[model samples]
Target: MDLDVFVAAHQAEWARLEQLLGRGRRLTGAEADELVALYQRTATHLSLVQSSTPDPMLTGRLTQLVARARATVTGTRRSGWRDAARFFTSGFPAAVYLTRRWWIPTALISTAVGVLVGWWIATHPEIQNAIGAPEDLKAMTKPGGGYETYYSSHPAASFAAQVWTNNAQAAAICLVLGGFLGLPVLYILWQNMLNLGVGIGLMSSADRLDVFLGLILPHGLLELTAVFVAAGTGLRLGWTVIDPGHRTRRVALAEQGRAALGMAIGLAAVLFLSGLIEGFVTPSGLPTWARITIGVAAEAAFLLYVYVLGGRAARAGDVGDVERADQTATLPTAA
Candidate 1:
């Protein structure tokens, strides 16, 4: 494998391919055929040189030439809009639907924990006393109190933006921290449940449970669902770190991480809708039943998206990852 002899042999073919590529749209049929042939030959030369020689300059030049020729052969790719269309239609939902086994139970268990804690606090006066003075708790639960006024504390637009930002941040944390064996995600979920339980307990004890439900349900259904999705996806990622099944740990983490990131983007949009409801519909003069109906509808639609669209995409082998061409891989070590 004399580097000089190899370069001398293939240099003309590589130069011809480069010249054809530089010709752009003006290439003739014969030139196009020649270009393809030279490109293949140069590719083999690249492989040979890579295996038998350590000539960095020659390898780099051939790499660049082959890449340029490939672009000329294949033409440019599709636009960004098409990619976005594909993502929402298939990738995002598929990722969510695939994680149903993880998230559905997360939702159920989180809800159960919140309910149990709320019930206990409502029934136990001593616990309430320990939490705070009865007067303060009473004030918060009373009509036109902290629970009711919190939604209206700021202008509607500002309030919606604030809520959206806060929730999105929480969701992002749950997703990114999932790689740390899911411990942080668990803590986040527990803290969320505890806070929700305390609020429900205080409201119920004050006989303002209806008020609490009316306001919370309108936004919470979708909002909490988004959070649960994040937490669930994160846990799945952590579990992948522990047990990657048939795939290597690195591959599993990368695949699941991409899926989790897709979920994060989808969840952001969901949380935005929830924030809108919280700022406008929840605190609006709409009847309690009407507001709750809107929340229920939104939640149902999201589930349908996951199960129908997502399930279809998953079955078709969409894993919410980038296109195959965009994936990173190491060169084969063996011939």
Candidate 2:
């Protein structure tokens, strides 16, 4: 790896590649072939210099030449509608489906927590008393009272938008902060389940648990699923920090982070649908059975989307990451 000797050998090829690149779209067939050949040789030369007896000045010059040649060899890539289509149908859903082992358990465990909290609050007069006076509880949980009326207090359209915004923010927080070893994500989940448990506990104490279910079931099914997905994904991100498996920590994080970001965008759309159900269907004049059915249908559709479409995409090697060409290049490290 004599640096001077190597530079002397390949300097002319590097210069020729640069001149061909400067010609832009005017390269003849023979010249284009020559350009491609020169580009390959220069790239190898750059790699050799970088890996052994590196010279900063020589490295910088060769790096620039290789990058220019690469761009000319492979035209620039731009994202278009096809990319968006692939994302929703393949990338986003596939990422979610792949994380099923993590999130499915998350959903089950969190649900149990909510139910246990509700049961504890319902049966314990001491806890209820600590929360508020009997009169206040009655005011809040009675039929057509605070719990039921809250959904309709605001106009339906505005309420839907507000719900969407809040849920999106919550999901985004889980995804972004999950990299903190998942502690913050866990606390956020606790707070959410606690709120739900209080509502259930108060309503059950008033002998209006059925009424509460009727109101919540119309949207809770899907809304909670999205939350669970975000939480699970965040936990996975944190776990990567602990055990990146075979990949380097930085590489694993980059891959997971990108997937989580795409998941956030996808979950926003899911939450938006649930928000619609909460704002309009939850408080509408429709029969309880009908509204709940609509909620169930929407939830079923989402599950199908994740399992069928996402499963297929994941099997085909889609990890919900941006296409390879879109990713930044990373040099290999010697162990």
Candidate 3:
């Protein structure tokens, strides 16, 4: 058949098939199968038309038709805030479970284990002498320095500034390192673990473990958890590119990016707040119980927001008929 005739015929059939498909709630299995068959027939006709034609206009028309079909099959509209809220909340429990079940425990255990091992190794008289321990370690059997000196030197303002800077740096690292194709992010996590371990070890060795915990535990829990969550987000992004499963890599990455970015934003907020607590509140001689209570409350609030409040907001948004109608209207239609 001539290319023009073939194109005109396929366009009519396509329109008819679309109308049939749109007539009811959804296409039944048999209807869906028939639709698939029609699509195959369309493809075959287009292939034959292209092979038979030398005219540029015919080729261009064929190209345009294929492009439209591809878009119809793959294109998705940008989800509005309501859709975003729903997705964010719906996934909250899973996020919390993942963090508490694995991320938090892993970071805590790893740091504790490293600290224990390091303290044991460092404090051994034989090793200490062999390594020619620093004079200060021998000179001060008691942990030196008071809260006044530490707070005065590092002040709340300075501390908050430092925390904010570090949190920003960590967030950037999570986004960049996690997007890589290899184990770069894992390596980054390992380095973080090592630093945490060493700090714990040093504090323990100085017999200032309680003091250190008082200062860190108040905010470290939130700040470090945020880091892990960010890393997890990155890992998901990398996984989409590396192991896209059934979907094309590009599609997988786009979908995962949307979900992961939401989590990352939440994590960044956590880090910022944690920094504030660490710099200002943690340094004050607040009662240990009060600090612990506040820390627990913060964590609880985070959990509730991510798991409960977030989900409720999303569901409400999803059920907004007016909003969905607006969205549908704005979406591009098949030509």
The clash count of every prediction, one per candidate, is 0, 0, 3
Candidate 2 versus the native: TM-score?
0.86
Tens-digit per-residue lDDT, 190-282, candidate 3: 777765654455556666767667766777777776777666666656766788777656555655555555555556667778878877777
List TM-score per model, in order.
0.80, 0.86, 0.60
- Report how far residue 235 has shifted in candidate 2, in Å: 0.8
Model 2 alpha-carbon miss at residue 284, Å: 0.6
Q: Residue 283 deviation, candidate 3, in Å?
A: 0.7
Query: Residues 221-284, candidate 2, lDDT per residue (tens digit)?
Result: 9999999999999999999999987777888899999999999999999999999999999989
- C-alpha RMSD values across all candidates: 4.5, 3.3, 9.9
Candidate 3 residue pairs in clash (backbone atoms < 3 Å): 86-314, 89-310, 89-311
Tens digit of per-residue lDDT, candidate 1, span 100-133:
8999999999999999999999999999999999
Give the Å shift of residue 318 in candidate 3.
9.5
For candidate 3, the 10 contiguous residues with the lowest summed lDDT are 324-333
lDDT of 1 at 286: 90
How would you order the candidates by TM-score, starting with the best?
2, 1, 3
Each model's lDDT: 0.88, 0.91, 0.60
Instruction: Judging by lDDT, tell me the better candidate of 1 and 3.
Output: 1
